[model samples]
Target chain A: MTPKMNSVGVIGLGSMGYGVATSCIAAGLETYGSDIRPEVCARLIAEGAADASTSPAAFAGRLDAVILLVVSAAQCEEALFGEDGLAPKLRPGVPVVISATIAPADSRRLGARLAGMGLPMLDAPVSGGSIKAGKGQLTVMAAGAPETFDAVAPLLDAMAEKVYRTGTQIGDGAMVKTVHQLLAGVHIAVAAEAMALAARAGIPLELMYDVVTHSAGNSWMFADRMQHVLDGDYTPRSAVDIFVKDLGLVNATGDSLSFPLPLARKAYELFAKASEQGFGKLDDSAVIMNYVGSELPGTRDN
Target chain B: MTPKMNSVGVIGLGSMGYGVATSCIAAGLETYGSDIRPEVCARLIAEGAADASTSPAAFAGRLDAVILLVVSAAQCEEALFGEDGLAPKLRPGVPVVISATIAPADSRRLGARLAGMGLPMLDAPVSGGSIKAGKGQLTVMAAGAPETFDAVAPLLDAMAEKVYRTGTQIGDGAMVKTVHQLLAGVHIAVAAEAMALAARAGIPLELMYDVVTHSAGNSWMFADRMQHVLDGDYTPRSAVDIFVKDLGLVNATGDSLSFPLPLARKAYELFAKASEQGFGKLDDSAVIMNYVGSELPGTRDN
Candidate 1:
């Protein structure tokens, strides 16, 4: 079936955004890419994006839908309503699908602001790292008005393998995503903790990894991230600071609700410490260094 | 080819133990059962065990191998060395495979004690819970001398679907199990923390569960234990104090090595608090009560 939205604009062409833009191109959508990095925009254009427009406003009016894949809610706001904001140039009723991991409250506020301008907003936060994003196999936890979801179904389909309609309330997607990040962040931290203890006890990290992946102890993060620990490669498929940021959002939401999330708080602290120790730019699995000190399993120091 | 060992003695017939005993019987072994509870011992006999002796000494000499599925290290030592102890009555070279979760140090100590009596021991802690145990599909993380493992191969094959030889060291299995518990315990607690946050935000617990199970946030424990949260069924499939004990073991190991496991420690505290608040006998998912208070998702209070 031909998708209704034939042309798409994807802002913030970082690792995730770049993948989304390329996937849209692969899905036969005329994709426009924007990023703070002009070189990345150029690279996306070379990779089959129809245009590498650094200014979203330049082609915003022609786009059928816009996807915001920036890092933070503030950036989501700035990109859409800032000095060179694209929302102002877009035609009314053009659905804006925000796939950034933002707070539900922020998402609700953004949806309200866009509604005031006659635009529809769907809070569609995504999971699965850039690898899946590049494969167009991301899982999108989305919530918005039914028509808004229908409007962006094709764009969502282009970038995601599974798109869950959380509810018609815009913030439901963000709330689910926040809870998801809570699990993802804690699982990574606990995987690191488990591995460090295994390493300290003189069990081979590879054997521990094999046993865990096959056992009830396994998690998607444990299977995926612990490989980096085994290989001693910290190339930052997802960096430490990302969880530091995401778990911080989790805690912020908990705080706003006067609810306590101790595990999330602890995981956030672990990531924050990893960031503080100069491992922030390293892979999230490098959080093991917080427990193992300088002697990582596959590293030269060991 | 027939297994090297044909007759087996299984001690402790609680949920996990009863399943293991039945699985051994199903494998065509002459399984003997021993439990403090006379009724459970009789029950195992009804399920085709060759004998159900309350006193291990009564059958220890005839068994080709013995499997201990008791609760703790002290109980393990008591079962083998206390009045009516089985070790003294067993023939030399009768491998004793201990499937109870215990500290590595305790396992090593038991290995030393058993070696003094010409008894070989395998530290073989199990996972997959009671259901898998009944299906004979549990994962066994075992460590012992190669000869000892070979001696009990048939019995291990009968009880476990996957048997990982962690190493030749007696304590290695315990270490791996401890590490596994570190992951499992933390995952359950974090699952509770995440679900609580979702419930607090008014997201349907069922939808959050579905989204997580399908996303990167998924873990074996979250998928298994959170169902209790959704059903509001606090039935003790695995109780809160089990993690209180397991994560306590995790932290004790951490303390011994001078390693810090902040996530495990936080999860342990959550479980301990749950236990303290009278949820200890409930399923481990009841840890969510620590976060959501009395208003659990499917409970009448909600």
Candidate 2:
């Protein structure tokens, strides 16, 4: 099995990153975690992680794959091969696996530059949310050369339930993630519209949600996310701002392909308005509050 | 129990209508069947249905209810109180249970006109579809006076697992049905969009559909319906024209309230386009053909 390169480096210990890093350690990798946040680095080290230096200077030959789990395409670029980037100091043969949800163009362009430097790249964006990630039940859509897959096969099997090899091209993984987020965003928006209509109709909100959920009228987004509106729980599982980024990715990608995504464009407007109305940090379902114009039905602080 | 009036008439003998009429007969009511097509009437007669024409005229005093399970609002109107309508011919106390999918305002107006004839009217639109109807497992949304619910309680119990007494106003049940259709129509559209994007990106669509149904992207619509697409079998469990009608109900209600249902509106437009493309008779999942521009991925037939 080519000696199983077992050491892995994970950058950005935010929600998704922390889950991935923990799952890596849980999967018995010598996992190293780095973040701009010192407390995150300390916490990971405290949790059986190999002590990691945030500076890329300490990583010349230890990692088989440096997984980027940051936020934006810009953040990914900054973390990878920036002035203090991982690309310059990391060992040449190890692959850089981009796990962040990002634009396909960014993945393809960066993959090309990395290929020129003799480092293989795997564009892998994950699903199943953070909780599943910590349990190593993530769905990873990965696209790269088959050689890149062969190099990191052991780590992938440990960290994910399924590793979908979309194509040899680097952008395909990001493309699938874009498609997933598009439905996710639209489903939530439609659920919101349904709920808002019920709310205006003066039907008991919870009863409406319960009946709709059990009936043919239900959607995955409605069943999972509408409870936030019913319980008035605006806690940020996946925040309102996440869709802002994801839908922007959709708009960008749709423009590139000349596809008219009216639903995606409309959903983006709603979420953008919700984010602008000071709910950028609340759970994505809180986008429903954009319509009701008040606190949700039953939420109260204990 | 207003003497448990023995005779009842059920108009229309499509799948849903036939099931309701048979359920009434199984409950020991002398149920009458009527349809524009004489063949449907002949089939119902073989199944122990009295012909509606003779039964309504000869047993007007004992007819307990005229259950209209016609497909649309227009058909329900035509049979119930239209020019040669049953409302004027039936003796006063019998209820007219409208199980058709229709607009609330239309149901409200019909209720008023039926009430003027001294007849109780229950706007009871059903869910759980035709199979559930045959099994008496549908959920009924019934709204009218207490006497109307009392009069129809046995029949409701026989036909449904749950009967929601939404309000003592006939329009409430229709309102709930409209809202239910709103969520259903939009969810199917989102599912099609998500699946289409995955198929184009070359993720074996069955795999993507399976994973997403298990993941955050799931809804009742996806779980119940996407299999038809994955199996490449569009056998019209619920037809595309059904959504066109349901979403029209959504827009009609939304317009009355001046609510901007952008997501649902766009979803309706897509289904409308699909219907215009000669797929109106196929399963609603065939809406994917609008995006995929062909029959379902593995299907031999359109």
For TM-score, the strongest prediction is 1
lDDT of 2 at A60: 44
Distance (Å) between predicted and true CA of A245, model 1?
A: 0.9
lDDT of each: 0.90, 0.82
Lowest lDDT block of 10, candidate 1 chain B: B293-302
- Give the per-residue lDDT of model 2 (tens digit) for B61-129: 557777888888788777866776777788767888888989999898888888888888899999988
Give the per-residue lDDT digits (tens) of candidate 2, residues A1-302. Answer: 44667888988888888988888898888888888988888888888998665764576468877888899889888887688888877777788899999988888988988888888899999888888888888889888989889888867876789888877889988987888788789889888888888877766777787778778887777888888887777889999999999999988987887666777888999999999999999999988877777666556331
Over 4 Å off in model 2, which ranges? Answer: A299-302, B5-7, B26-29, B50-61, B231-235, B292-302
DockQ of 2: 0.63
Per-residue lDDT value at B189 in model 2: 81
For candidate 2, give fnat to 2 decimals: 0.64
The superposed Cα distance between candidate 2 and the true structure at residue A155, in angstroms, equals: 2.7
